[model samples]
Target: MESFKSILSAKGPSLFLLPTWMEQNEYLTAGFTSRNGGVSEEPWASLNVGLHVGDQDADVVRNRQLIAEAIDWPFEAWTCGEQVHGSDVFAVTEVERGMGRLSRASAIADTDALITNVPGVLLASFYADCVPLYFYDPEHQAVALAHAGWKGTVQQIAIRTIEAMEKQYGSKPEQIRCAIGPSIDDCCYEVDGFVIDKLQPLVQELANLVNSVPESMLTLVENGKAMVNLKQINRHIMLKAGILPIHIELSEWCTGCSSDQFFSHRKEGGKTGRMASWIGIRER
Candidate 1:
């Protein structure tokens, strides 16, 4: 079996590889499993964590169990959201823990962001082409996991999430470690007119900074006017929000192009299964 010991030791929040230390019971470790690891059939084959994707519930449960076991934890401690694609962020508190999907309804609703200070409380959010933003504040022992698609991205979900962490847990951006997980990269992520127009205004200056045409036109630019690196844009949002660029780690892997490794909705035309990302501080 391929191991992630070296990958984890290398340091950076955007690890495709899981760390033994992080899995060792009391560390603020975070990792996302690729579509590469488990046991299922075609379409949902190998390590598919998404439940509603037509993969049998038994297979989904078994797959999730393998994923959780690989991460060195029981599936029960893991908390996941229904993922409505909005910018709502939730605080995983004592009352909310154990009351959510591992058993019943989530403590919150219509949310895409999850924050928790309760160790052993693993919070998960789903994504395919959408970006997964994982936030860990060691100072406050709090962590947040968010799923940001184009809509959520334009809405400034990253900034809003950082703001929420500060408002509720007294977390400062400087002390936070943020990782932007695997998603459709700039090169392969092409969009349409409506999206560009809606995003252009909100990301005017920000887009200008990342979406440069400087004497060159990009085919992917909607209406042949603007092109963008959504990952960089989200990174910029975090930077402006006070997250250090050095502290922010991004996976160079693009879901759209890396079809064998990840499940991309665009690459597969909406027939793809989703991937889950999470972070937690152990109670022990």
Candidate 2:
């Protein structure tokens, strides 16, 4: 019953696809990329889709293009954001459909989330240990991607993306299907007081709203630190925003634990490449 299923291709990039979403709508292509099947070299090793992570820009773009080809999406439709780990969500339009695919300068700036109802426009966001949040509104045919590191999670970027979808595409939260993609899990994500401070209030608020306990989302460890479950916290935010529990899919692939298949910033000491989470409605 795993929501994200791995699909290995001999000719192109390997992917972890959200099968239910693709099954529900054949025109939809939604999945996370594995750090395999690309043209980049060491640290980046293979499939690094991030343009700003010190990898050669051409290599990154080639990797991204390989992904686009693997998914049957036009490389020109591959769009992205300049993630700043904030709660800002940018509503992508037709005019901005292909920005940031080739370089960081053309990408949507200072945004952690990108939503679009436009067909043929791929919304992609890069991640190392950060969480990748996916939102799809079947009724509106809109898809969104959010990059939620601890900072963005604390800022409630999940809620911001849902609200933006509601405002821009009339997407009712209850009708919105969400997915939490591969990232570092609580088992491998230990943080200091600085992060815990930001998370505590949000965890408390979520507990009060859901009638649960804050400890369910965070575990205290030695030296004023905690092992945080960012994916669960974001799921709670989705619930608090009115997305039904049945409508959300959570992935169990932990980047830190599965570093051979993913690029883990924590496991690799901040010098790793990035994987991409992408969602788009293919042109009919």
Candidate 3:
């Protein structure tokens, strides 16, 4: 079954929700947003929650507010980072809550991942063709969000997040639930030798964990470029990091293929809006 289920309404912002997770824990709110039903114009056309993508800050904030309202989360609880496509992980405290919701300057600087055990603090990250990784530790009631592009993936941002959770919240990997949200898939993500070379070491190590060969994670094609399955690579990384396979949920929605529903930097030639992946435990 698809992990991220679409929630659409004629007059409301479109969202893709993790029904299973929400059903398992009523206080938890986790999902991704689609690029429909916002106030941005032209390339941003609709629901663009990224404040750094040159979209009108007012429009982006409104879009984010719409998502918060739709999910019944306080807009003030929305916390985010100034994603730099690096492996840096920031552990958000209550003080950091709502930092980047209104503007980029207030966002956590130079971080690609944000983890927090603080209830009511919504952890959100923007994405356009890059992977959105979600982590939840029900035992500790902690939730996290990571933005993974090729750079972050090769840097092993997933492991960094899990380790951070372990250190900050005592979250055991076996008890951690992880979900890979919509992004550019191998079908749409082609990389050159520079990227493939960076992935080579990790792919070699991942081979021992997966049943299939490393090629399943990174397939080399003609002209010296390779199709990188970032989602699978992340899953394997999670597995290697001790997260159970059953605890991992992967989405099939490809941003490149679903331009009508997502923002794809590659498919849209870098001039595009962004969708958000958010996870938080509502305050009681």
Candidate 4:
């Protein structure tokens, strides 16, 4: 079964929820938002939750609030980071619980991944086509959200997040459950030589770790370009980081292919809305 199950209604935020995770842990909530049922205008028409995407601040906040309401999370707990496509992982603390909820300036700076053992601090990251990597260390009641574009993927953001969880929360990698959310799949994500070159070393390392072939992560096309599988590469990276394969959930929804259901920066030619991936444990 597809791990990210869609929950749609007539007039609310459309969501793809991780039912198994939420069901297994009563206090936990994890899912990705869709581009429908919001208040933005064209290009970013409807549900665009990104505050920095040139959308009206009020509209964007309202959209975010709609998601928070739908998920039954307080909007004040919606914490986020200013994604720079880097490998830096920040452990969100209680004092920083609501940073970036209303504005970008208040958001955690220079980070692509946010991890927290702090219950009630919802870790959110925006994405259009970039992969959204999720980590849950049930042993520590901690969760994380990572934004992985090609740059962050090459830099091994997933590994960085695992390390952060281990160091900050005493989370064992073997106990961390991971999920790759909706994003541009290999069929829709074509890359040039520059990206391929950056990925070559890691691709080789992934093969060695999983005893898999290069094509499992990168398929070379013609004219110095190739189709790259960010999700699979990140999965291999998670395996290399000591996460069990059975504990990981991978989404099949491709943003680039399903523009109606998602906002694809690549398919939409860069003027697009952003969906959010969130994981939080309700304060008890």
Candidate 1 lDDT tens digits, 1-284: 22222222112111264343254435656777677656667787656777767776677667666666666776777777667778888877866664344422443567889887777887877778899898877788788988899888888899889999999999999988788878887677777787777666656565465554322212344455455567777787787788987678776777888787778888888876777786777666
Q: Per-residue lDDT of 1-284 in model 3, one digit per residue for the tens?
A: 78999999688799999998999999999999999988898889899988877889999999999899988888999999999999999999989999988888999999999999988899999999899999999999999999999899999999999999999999999999999999999999999999989998999889876665998799999999999999999989999899998999999999999999999999999899999999999878
> In model 4, what lDDT does residue 197 have?
92
lDDT of 2 by residue, 1-284 (tens): 67899998777888999999999999999999999888899989899988877999999999999999888888999999998989999999999989999999999999999999999899999999899999999999999999999999988999999999999999999999999999999999898998898899999999999998888799898989999999999999999999999999999989999987999988898887999999999888
Quote the lDDT for 103 in model 1: 23
By summed lDDT, the worst window of 10 consecutive residues in model 1 runs over: 5-14
* Model 4 per-residue lDDT tens digits across residues 233-272: 9999999999999999999999999998999999988898
TM-score of each: 0.84, 0.98, 0.98, 0.99
Query: lDDT of each structure?
Result: 0.71, 0.93, 0.93, 0.93
Please report the candidate that would top lDDT against the real structure. 4
- Which residue runs does candidate 1 get wrong by more than 4 Å? 1-15, 18-26, 98-108, 207-227
TM-score of 3: 0.98
* Model 2 clashing-pair count: 0
Candidate 4 residues lying further than 4 Å off, grouped into runs, are none
Give the distance in Å from residue 178's predicted Cα in candidate 4 to where it truly belongs.
0.4
